[model samples]
Target chain A: MRAVDARVRALESILVEKGYVDPAALDEIIETYQHRVGPRNGAHVVARAWTDPAYAERLAADATAAVAELGYGGRGGEHLAAVFNSAREHHLVVCTLCSCYPWPVLGLPPVWYKSPAYRSRAVLEPRAVLAEFGTVLDDDVAVRVHDSTSELRYLVVPQRPAGTDDWPADALAAIVSRDSMIGTRLVSV
Target chain B: MFDEPWQASAFALAVALQDRGVLDRRDFAVALGGELESGHDYWDAWLAALEQLLAEHGLTNPGSLDERTAAWRRAAAATPHGSPVTLDADPQRLRHP
Candidate 1:
């Protein structure tokens, strides 16, 4: 693992030397990640929710307990909660101060989630950010922004896509990307 | 050293930020070198240094590191799980819905 990390770092340095990323931009990116993405524990929880509605309700109400029930709770998932997104009310989440996430299930957060563009703009302009991810909210749909804080963490439980009705829970999991779990994009059918 | 793509992408963001002039190259390089030596992941070390710099330079008020850290924590907590990524409530009955 360490060797791979070093190689990757070396490669990144090479890219920077080659003028791929400016010096300052690199700092911002670093700031975004260490401070943004949390754990991947959220993924298992999400998968469970999709397969079991009863569990989904439990997760939505009390994330920590719900996760513990599934025996997949730890790290950033110490305190967890689920937020549901639907056609009427679209929800987007961001950590305006930093990147706090349900890592036990979701793995790591995407780079954009940690960027100043994402952190600062997510609260100020959620619709725009979602649009960048190709999520177009209807005018009638109200966009709600949830800011993740230290005391309470949030997860978006997106509604299952239309054509995916026939897919079993395991098959459905394949199409669920981290971005979709973050509420930035919906599962592509 | 992140084994995941998101981890690598996070490093990419730092590089991109340096390229964009949001951070000073010399200071960042110094911090990165120190972090690599201490076995800290690239991003972890950079954030620690940034936090320190912010405090040392009075960019943020003293004794507010906790607040800043908490804010970052919140962002990470807000990610969604499951398919289609909708933001509603949890699926469990353990907590108040």
Candidate 2:
């Protein structure tokens, strides 16, 4: 195993040396994939939850099963779970150990999700981080921080914003940004 | 630096997959050594190589891969840190009503 790992590393070095990738460009691609895909998936899931109470129940009970029901259970979605956010209690998600995410549901996790600042500070001072993201919880609201591990991943289901009453599920989904699902931002009115 | 962007992506994917323990390091090293024009092409090629490796090693048998990935997902879902917040149970539950 060690020998194999070494070889893989060496080959990667060669690829870098050969100029196949600019370390920076690769970073950008990964970032784009994360941003574009993550929020879209979150919006879809949020829309489904809003339109179908039964689906929301299933998602809360078992995310993976519920997602599979939608035919979105492949690739990074093998292990999916949802943490529904309500008015009284708020939930925030962070990956402290590594960037373990529900890629199937949210595509890729944003770079900030995996940063040391996010991982460390999210658990230690979640309110501050959320504040930075422009999410302000009332003093009475208790903030709960969830740390994602390699095996378990999480997505926040934001409380349905007001004035979205007549909108169709698809329309409602448009406002469910990735940041909102991460507990960093709230769904706009 | 290489002309093709895919090659670089391929290299990045290889490293990412290896880091994630999705592919065997030995095979990745062997396949990568064979050569390509640029880093951009690396990701596409690496994925093809990985799929081939999976088939060659008989790792593609009868939903086994899906089952393994499912297990990984289950493990991730079972994590206790994140749970749904119920309005009634939460002391801070928003009382807009």
Candidate 3:
């Protein structure tokens, strides 16, 4: 372990000694959040919104409560704000302050989301950012950028694909890519 | 991240502190933002922010972070190679809540 690593280890040992945290419970927490928290939690929310107008209304009104109803709660999901996409406008999520992401809903943020390049450019040129992700929107549509903070994080709900009218909510969720929820990619087929 | 053992340890330490209300989430974000503005490496800043709050909250004692860190350096050097390093207060731990 390097110096910083050693320091961190010392810190953890100290914290454990102080009884502030239990080693077993910390292991469980790490197990719960490592890599991706399935990333499907947000997909379920999106699919439910698409198939049920009433649920969608509740989501738009109280993003946090709606997410908790689905049994997910933590940092980013605690004070969430969902932004729904539409024919006239688009929404993209970024955190200029830091890599504050909706971890409970979308799992750990992708590496690019934490990169300074994406942080600066996403707000400066969202359309270009989206295009770089291979999502080309119509010229007349407006692109909206949502910056995340510790107090509130935003999730983009991409419009349901055109041919998915007959698809079940589970099927719709299966097609909801992580990037779509992050607003970097649009769902298709 | 798995490639670096400390990365996960650093992350876990921060989470545990925050979970116990020893570190404030909003305050932590502000510290991170400041570190980023100063051009520190992302992970360095994350570690620094946690260290900052840890020190402020007296988890390692306010002015003793440097001392404790240096102590670890000594401990690691004294421990035989291929064996896990143990602090002077090893296993017994140093405090009671």
- Best model number under DockQ: 3
Name model 3 segments beyond 4 Å from true: B1-3, B61-63, B70-84, B88-97
Candidate that scores best on lDDT: 3
Model 3 Cα lDDT, one tens digit per residue, B4-92 = 76777777777776777878889998988888778887778888888777667666674456556666776777777888887763332
Q: Order the numbered candidates by TM-score, best leading.
A: 3, 2, 1
Off by over 4 Å in 2: A1-37, B1-97
Candidate 1 docking DockQ: 0.08
The TM-scores, one per candidate, come to 0.56, 0.59, 0.89
Worst 10 residues of 3 chain B by lDDT: B88-97
Model 1 bad stretches (over 4 Å): A1-41, B1-97
lDDT of 2 by residue, A147-187 (tens): 76545678889989888888999899898988888888888
**lDDT per residue (tens digit) for residues A78-162 in model 3:** 7999999999989999999888998888987777888888999999989899899999999998999999999899989999999
lDDT of 2: 0.63
Q: How close is each model in CA RMSD to the real structure?
A: 19.0, 20.7, 3.2
In terms of lDDT, the poorest run of 10 residues in model 1 chain A is A1-10
The residue pairs that clash in candidate 3, if any, are: none
